[model samples]
Each structure stands twice: as C-alpha cells, then as structure tokens.
Target: MTAVLDEAIKKASITWVSVGDGPAYALWCMPVESSLIVVTGPGEQHAPGLTSAPTATVRLRGDHGGLIVTAEATVTRLDHAGEEWAEIAPQLAGKRLNASGPAAEVVARWAATGCAIVRLTPAEGTPVTAPHLPDDSAAAPPRETPARVETRRPFRLHRVRPPRT
Candidate 1:
C-alpha cells in the first residue's frame, strides 16, 4: 500500500493550513505537484476560525487505463510555541514550484505574506499508498507501502498558546 501512497503522493497536492493572527487559510496544491487532476474536483472544506488550525483531507485518485490509486490526507498548520512569524516567512517562497494554477496561486499568496509551506506529517496509523492490486484477483485487496508520517517540523506563522482559558 505504501507504493500506492507514494504514487498518490506523486499525484497528491501538498496542502497546508495557516493559522495564528488572522483568518485561517486553506491552501491545496491542486494535484499538488504535477499536472492537475482532470475531471475531479478539489475537496476543500470551510475555513477555520482564529486560534484554530483549518484542516483539509484530500483524496487523490489516478487512473491510467488500468492503474487506479486512492489516498487520504489531512493537512494542518503547525503551531510553533512562541515563535515569531518572521522566522518562517523566508522558507515559504523556497518551496514554490514553477507549476501554474491553484498551487501557483497558493505559492504566490504565501510568498506575498512570507508564509512558508507546511509539510504534511502523517500521524500514527495514517494511511499510505501502495502498488495496485493484480487485475486478475478480484478478491485481493491492493497492497500498501510501509509509509508513515515519521515526524513533521513545520514552520508556522503564529505562536502556539498555552491551554486556552
């Protein structure tokens, strides 16, 4: 299944939420890094409130004649404890790729605000993609790769607060 996730990741749009000072923003890569995923729509949800991180879980599927893939993703804003936004601003533009459309727009916006792209760190028991199942075996399930969100040290735009009042 890991291979499927990898393939999905390749087709997956890296998305992240920016939370802290102002209104939260949900930005997705739109097929994420490669050519846009045609036909399907972007499964973005409503925005997040202040002091909360907006999250988006996207399902990516790729079909090339016979191959099919499916993956689930949850993107969140990393809350840095007492870290100033300025420190992470510079890294945002660095992650921008030359691709156009939504991703380019997100990068442009992040670049403008000096916001960095947050990496998606899969949590324990998170789902990952793997190689496709054998076409002949209708009863067999698709294989999964051994991939997990090791650890994510995402740059944040706001300071993390202690327990809320």
Candidate 2:
C-alpha cells in the first residue's frame, strides 16, 4: 500500500463533507474510539437545533478495508479547552483537518443550538482501498511516450452574499 493509503487508515481524523440547504461545507473530523469531533463556524446554518449535523457517511479511500461507519449519530460541542487542543494537535498528528478558531467554534457552539451528539457504530463492511496504478510485468509490451497538454488561466474571484436569514 502507498503511504497515503496507510496514513488514511491510521488517521484518526477525516474530512467531513456536510451537505445542507446551501452549498456543501467540508469540515475536519477527528474520530475517537467510538465518536467524532469537528470544527465549524458560528452561524444559524451550523448552529444546533437550527442547523443539521452531518451524517457519518464518510468515504474511506484505502487499500485495506476502508472503514465506512454506517449508523445513527449525535452531535456535540467539544468544550473550549478541548477545542483549543484539537486545533494544534490534529496537524502535528498528520491528519486531514483545518484547525482555525472559526472552524473549531462551529463544533463548540453546538450546545447553544441544542444539537445532539451522536455515536456511530459500523453496521456493514467498511469499504477498502484498491491500487490506483496498474501492476507492471516483465512480459508487458513496450510503451511509447505521449504528448502533454498544457493550459493556464489567470486567477479571478466572484463574491456573492450568503442566502437570506
């Protein structure tokens, strides 16, 4: 297995892609032994009771059995102290996460919005990783070089207001 796959399996944290009323948002998810923690922003969309917590429909990409946790869940805010620690720790641990204060606040603010914390237990076989590159053999036909295509675009930005309250 490649280092990426190995790390993915070992990583306690995974990216959480939340699909909601508006555009999708991706958060960093830290999976503890049985539960997960995330960092998000402070807004009605993310607020508890008002905003919906994302499902644990994680798509693991790996060589071994990638763990797909299919189960009901609850959401909660990690205390301030815990959130602070999670910010700096996840990076040092070499997991996928965005550790900004705004992101962490989203998880911490869950209580104010009355969002429930959930625990996910896998009910089915988790998806596993497969090799992305094909295996090479000594008997394989000789290969030829291919031409390259290059394109470039200047940076641009288009900003719009968030949806109505």
Candidate 3:
C-alpha cells in the first residue's frame, strides 16, 4: 500500500491534516524510502504546525485514485548532521525550488531559517483505512485568527439531478 501511496503523492499533493494546523496540501512532498517526507515552513506551501504534531492523517490523490495513510510524524531539524539525514539530504535539497549549487549547500541555506524536514511513517499497529476525510482539495486551510473566529457557517448541500427522459 505504501508503494501505491508513494506513486500517488509523487504525482499530486497530499492533503495533510494535523491538530492546530487545520489542514493543508503540499506540492513539494517526496517519498523517501518506505516513508514520506515533506518540508514546510514560512516560505513553503504546507502546514507549519506539522512540527507540533505526533499523529496526523496524510491523503494522496491522483489519477490512480486515492488512499488515506494515518501517519506518525517525526520532526527533524534539517540543520543538524546525521547519517540518516546525510543520505536523504540530496533528495530533499534537490526538491527545493530555485536551489543553486550542491544539495549540501542548499540544505545549509534552507535550514538556516529554523525550517524542518518532517518524516511521516504509517502509524504502527493500525491498519490502513478507507479515506477518513472528506475531499477538501478545492478549499483553503481555515484560518484560526481572531478576525475569522466569527465566520463559522453551517454546511449546505446543493443536490443535482439529471433530467428524466
């Protein structure tokens, strides 16, 4: 299933839902080994609160269909040096937009701003489930700001029916 998920996320953004961060999708995600890796912060396109999450739901959507992978997220400081990070650094850095020079150099500059690389693995002891989240692919993440606090609106359904022959 991870193999199937890998191919999907590689083709489309993952709808990531984590506590406090609401939900956000990313176009800058990569499947590293058996796990999926994503980098997000002020300059990136995904949720920054992923760093504070221990568990989150990751959804992959594409022409091949979609799958929901409940994952345990581990936050790693990309600025640090480690053997595991070393091996994947190139792959991560190469995905950085407009990155110049080698991966090592790009990583240094990328991580210099307190950014992080998040490694997500399928949650242990939990079987992969059917899509547990409704499709929000067309909606933006909800802002929790005070100005938006009074904007709660109930959901309404717009039913469509084909004309009877």
Mind giving the per-residue lDDT tens digits that candidate 3 earns over 28-141? 667765566777665555575677677666655556544444444444444446676667767888876776778888777656766667776655544344465445544665
Model 2 score (lDDT): 0.39
Displacement of the residue 66 alpha carbon in candidate 1, Å: 11
RMSD of 2: 15.8
Deviation (Å) of 36 in candidate 2:
3.4
Query: Which residues of candidate 2, in runs, are more than 4 Å off?
Result: 1-10, 16-25, 39-56, 61-108, 131-165
Per-residue lDDT over 1-165 for candidate 1, one digit per residue giving the tens place of the 0 to 100 score: 355555655654433233343332334443333222211112223334412334323334455423343233344343333242234423333343543445446434544543433334333344434444444522234334465446878888998889978
Between candidates 2 and 3, name the one with more favorable lDDT. Answer: 3
Please tell me which predicted candidate would have the highest lDDT against the true structure: 3
Segments of candidate 3 deviating more than 4 angstroms: 1-17, 64-79, 100-102, 125-165
lDDT of 3 at 10: 55
Tell me the whole-model lDDT of each prediction, alpha carbons only. 0.38, 0.39, 0.59
Q: CA shift at 21, candidate 1, in angstroms? A: 24
TM-score of 2: 0.33
The whole-model C-alpha lDDT of candidate 1 against the native structure comes to 0.38
